[model samples]
Target: MKATPADQQELLRLQSIDTRLQQLAHKLGALPQTAPLAELAQRETAVRGTRAEAIGALEDARSELTRLESDVAVVEARIARDTDRLQHTSSVKDVQALEAELASLAKRRSDLEDQELVVMERVEDAEVVVSSIDLQRAAIESEVAELEAERDAAAGGIGVEREQTERDREVVAAGVPAELLAFYEQRRARGAGVGAALLRQRTCGGCTMTLTGSDLEQVRRSAPDDVVQCPECDRILVRTDESGL
Candidate 1:
């Protein structure tokens, strides 16, 4: 395919734009915050599970405390009725029985109060555990929000540049002959995004290999309008003053 020398040079510009766009896409996907954000999500899930266990422990402690309180209440009620009877009765036998029963009730109340104290401590400890887990979860959530904001900001900047680059490509591509542009596109797809390169200082710019011997002689013999492809890389070679032919 024959394209004017000027038209061929525009392919290098198009290639540069395409390369920049590819770099921008890679940068957007590789933002530093992406990995940490994913890690934070997993941490939050584990903390939630721990919080659930702590809550269950607290509930169990509270239930035990409630049972102990009820037991103490029943013991105190019995002691009160027995003391009232002792005050009214005059028989010596009844006095002894009432005194003994009062002593047993006092012992039972003391034991129940002791049990309640222990269970109350357990409840307090359980509450502390739950509170600590809540703080951990909150911290993870805060970090996640921060990272998401950073990621979004970075993506927004890249997106703006990409849009402008695409516009630039459209303008540059419009000037090329239809046949040449289509041919370049096909070569670009097969050549890793590079359809044309400058033949600079006796080197094939596409492959960065210097042309020598018959290869150099062949390119030197070609006409200015001839579409020459590199024997090594098959990319269209656009010659210029720097080609060093």
Candidate 2:
């Protein structure tokens, strides 16, 4: 393939813009927020599980407390009935028996009341745990939202810049010969991000590999309008005044 010296230079400029565009695409795909956002989402799920368990514990504690309260009420009722019996009894033995029964009911009620207090404490503690977990889940969700927004804005800026760069590439690519442009595009389609580069100071800019010995001699002998490719990377080497031919 052959292109004028001016066309070769335009191709290099077009390559530069295309390289920037590729880099922008890479940055957009590998946004920094991606990993952290994923981690935050996992944490949110785990914390929510903890919150669910806490809620279950709270319900269990409340149920126990209710049972204890009912037991205490029954015991107090028995004590009241026994005391009324003692007042109506005429026999000393009956009175003594009624007092003894009242003492046993009082002891039962005291034990039930104590158990109720312990369960109430557990319920309060579980409530605190649930509340703390809820706040944690909310914070993680909020952070995830913020990171997503930041990532989107960054990608949007890259999108605008890439659009502008593409416009410039189109204009520069217009000046290149059609056959040469088609060849360049084919090379790019074959997974070569760079289709062309400048040969400056005997170095291939595409691969940053300096040509030496016979390879250097061949490029040096090639005409200025001649299109050449790098032996290492197969990218077109565009000759320029700075090529040190």
Candidate 3:
């Protein structure tokens, strides 16, 4: 294919942009914050699970405390009834029975109070667990937010630059012949982002293989308007005065 020197140089420039675009796309995919954010999300899920368990424990403790307090109230009412009987009855047997019942009631009430105290302590401990989990969640969220902001701020500039570079590539590509650009794109796809290489100092910039002997002579003999392909890697060999041809 025939291309003027200027058009050939434009192809090289387009190649440069495409290469950088490929790099930018890779960078965008592998943003620094992405892995950490994912890890933090997993930790967040685990922490929320812990919080859920803490809530369940607190609820159970509160429920047990309520039931114990209710039992204590019932016991106190029974003792009051027995005390009233004592005040009214003068029989020895009746007085003795009432005192025995009151003593038993007192013991029951003491046991319920102890159980209530234990439940109350569990509730307090559960509350502490909830508080600790909440702090952990807040710290994780703050770090996630910070990482997200950093990723966005850092990527913002690269994103804009990539967009502009892509636009410029389009404009430059439009100036080239359709067949040449298509060929370049196809070769770029097959050659891993390099369709054309600068033939500098007898070296194939695409493959880094030096052209020598008859190969170098062939490139040297080629007309300036004619496009040349490297014999080793089959990439377009773009020539300049520095080609050492």
Using TM-score, give the best candidate's number: 3
Q: lDDT value for candidate 1? A: 0.90
lDDT of 3 at 210: 96
- What is the C-alpha lDDT profile of model 2 across 165-224, one tens digit per residue? 899988988888899899888766663688888899989888899999999998888887
Q: Could you give candidate 3's per-residue lDDT for residues 1-245 as a string of tens digits?
A: 88887778788998998989999989977998888999999999999999999999999999999999999999999999999999999999999999999999999999999998889999999999999999999999999999999999989988999999989998989999988888888888889889999999999999999998999889888899898888988888899888887
Identify the superior model by lDDT, candidate 1 or candidate 3: 3
State model 2's lDDT: 0.86
Model 3 TM-score (2 dp): 0.55
**Stronger candidate by TM-score (1 vs 2):** 1
User: For model 2, what is the error of residue 115's alpha carbon versus the real structure, in angstroms, after optimal superposition?
Assistant: 45
lDDT, candidate 1, 1-245, per-residue tens: 78888888888888888888889878887899878987998899889989999999999999999999999999999999999999999999999999999999999999999999999999999999998999998889889999999899878988899999999989988988888889888888889988888899999889998999999999999988888899998988989999998
What is the Cα-based lDDT of residue 179 in candidate 3? Answer: 84
Clashes per model (N, Cα, C within 3 A)? 0, 0, 0
Please report how far candidate 2 places residue 211 from its true position, in Å.
1.9
Determine the backbone clash count of candidate 2: 0
The Cα local distance difference test for each model comes to: 0.90, 0.86, 0.91
TM-score of each: 0.54, 0.52, 0.55
Ranking by TM-score: 3, 1, 2
